[model samples]
Target: MSAKKEEQTAAPAFNLEKAMMDYSGDKYELIVMASILAAQKGKNEEFRFQPRDKVIKASLAEYLAGKITREQLVETYMSERKLMEEKQAQEEKRLEQKAAAPRLELKLSGESL
Candidate 1:
């Protein structure tokens, strides 16, 4: 019973420093990507998170686990940005068309005198 309790109490250890050191890519880029991912995770509930999970740590863990890559992140960001810019352009075009459109004013017969 004591052995089972002890085993259950032991949590898997995660060494961020070691993981960072072992990563084959640029360390600075990794940190930047992780920071961005952490910010996104913190602001959104797209992923189910445990109450004890910290966004920064979770993001790092995902990277370490090979679930996400820096290239994938960059590509996703670029695509989303492109979509936003396209939407803005379309909105601007629509607004210009609306502004250029002609408007008609109906005059009251009683005021014509």
Candidate 2:
């Protein structure tokens, strides 16, 4: 008798709602879960999933699970970190310019004048 072997398939994309339904305890549960998963997946050794990444992953999972659409998830990951960094850099430049500015003082006719 001949036996047939099944083809292996990649794991289904993560499902946020299903995960939430499965874990259903707190709001941050999804973030924590994704972080743990990401850590295990070795996405980053620092294992520090930025807030933006956390939101993105959660929303993406939800969309993949048919709970939300890709468009909805698009804005969820938009982070202002880059803008903030640029603003900080500009502020530092301004400060450095100010510090580098020259100061002038004039002393006229001490009391003898």
Candidate 3:
């Protein structure tokens, strides 16, 4: 077998441009890619799961390459961001309510409001 044929039989090299082109027509997949990009940017160096970002990026590329649809990628990342935002908002509201609550203190026997 020729060296070129052997190389071809080897795993294909990763191609980001092709992946992006593939998913360019998909709005949801684009959104998912954006979110994954965001998450990767926000990841801390101390964390062990940072490698997942690469996986997500690869998946995005694969999806863009027509190996997967926008819906599939969207279902995971889009919903996760939505749910996280909602939970964050709820927590913020709860904290605000707690902060806004009136404080009461016990007075001495002779004290009165």
Candidate 4:
């Protein structure tokens, strides 16, 4: 086995590019806890699991409702982002279909058909 092949087959590094982990002493060390969990769970080669600001806000709703724990924030963000991406894909496909379809002209009541 070549070292280069082994290196290529190795697992991708976890990337969490955010300052959320910097703050402490508030909310029971939840930020650090969530950061750790996100790093552990969000392992992918294509992209890092970066929750958008909106995703963070949306997850806060779930947190407030007691539906999700603080540590689940990143996980919740992933779920919401995936669902949003799916909806966006569907909408884009629909628009393409609409654009491809032929349009019909409708005559006004007072105009000739």
Best by TM-score: 1
What RMSD value applies to candidate 1? 4.4
| Candidates by lDDT, descending order | 1, 3, 4, 2
lDDT digits (tens) for residues 1-113 of candidate 2 = 22332223545656566665775346574554444444333444443455656655654464345564334333333343466688999999999999999976666877432
- lDDT tens readout by residue for model 1, 10-77: 99677777887788888788878887677567657765463334677789878887888778888877
How does candidate 2 fare on TM-score? 0.35
Best of the candidates, lDDT: 1
The order by descending TM-score is: 1, 3, 2, 4
Off by over 4 Å in 2: 1-19, 23-29, 32-79, 106-113
- lDDT by residue (7-37, candidate 3, tens digit) is 9899998787765665436677475665564
TM-score, structure 4 vs. true: 0.35
Off by over 4 Å in 3: 1-5, 8-60, 104-113
TM-scores for every candidate against the unseen true structure: 0.65, 0.35, 0.45, 0.35
Clashing pairs in 4: none
Lowest-sum lDDT 10-residue window in model 1: 45-54
- Give residue 96's error in model 4 in angstroms: 0.6
Cα lDDT for residue 36, candidate 3: 60
Candidate 2 vs candidate 4: the lDDT winner is 4
